[model samples]
Target: MKKFQVVVKCSLGIHARPAAQIAQACSNLRAAVTLETDHETAQGNNVLEILNLHAAKGATVTVTVDGPDEEEAAQKIQAVFEAMGPKEKKVPVLKVAFFGTKDYDRLY
Candidate 1:
């Protein structure tokens, strides 16, 4: 088994999009992959399991690969994490209106 650690830098964390990409990548590989974050461990090929991790941005995650293509799997996953930019705080967009106020307008 081969093990390595990587930090999740995607602004959205390990949400659906990233999880799907990861799962697909793992599915295409021959190695068995596992991802660990906090007390949670997920199969790399399982998108739902990966999403359940809810790995916040900037969290350091451990990736373990075992089987014939361990090295390649590790490298590919590492590259994916590295490609995502550093964690960022997401800004919330809100719209408010005052009752009976004709001048009310949406704020950008």
Candidate 2:
């Protein structure tokens, strides 16, 4: 078994997007991963379980991976959390714009 701690960085916490991403990543690994925060433990590969954690920004979360690939799984899960946004930093929503090109009319 392997365990590591990560801080939540998303502005909205582990909401749908982050939760889904984490779940998918964990699901790809062979280890049994779980996340612990605020005295609550959640299955890392379950979107709903992770979402139920309600881990807000700056909150420290502990992830545990157990099985044959525990070490690699821990590292991968840690990387995912680290690349989420920023440690202890909140992400701001940005507006995006789409530009039309010469082929736009053809597609329309």
Top TM-score hit: 1
TM-score of 1: 0.77
Q: Model 1, which residues run further than 4 Å from truth?
A: 86-108
Backbone Cα, N, C clashes tallied per candidate? 0, 0
TM-score of each: 0.77, 0.75
Top lDDT hit: 1
- lDDT by residue for model 1 (49-80), tens: 99888898889899999999888898888877
Q: Candidate 2, TM-score vs. the true structure?
A: 0.75
lDDT of 2: 0.86
Question: Which portions of model 2 show Cα errors greater than 4 Å?
Answer: 86-108
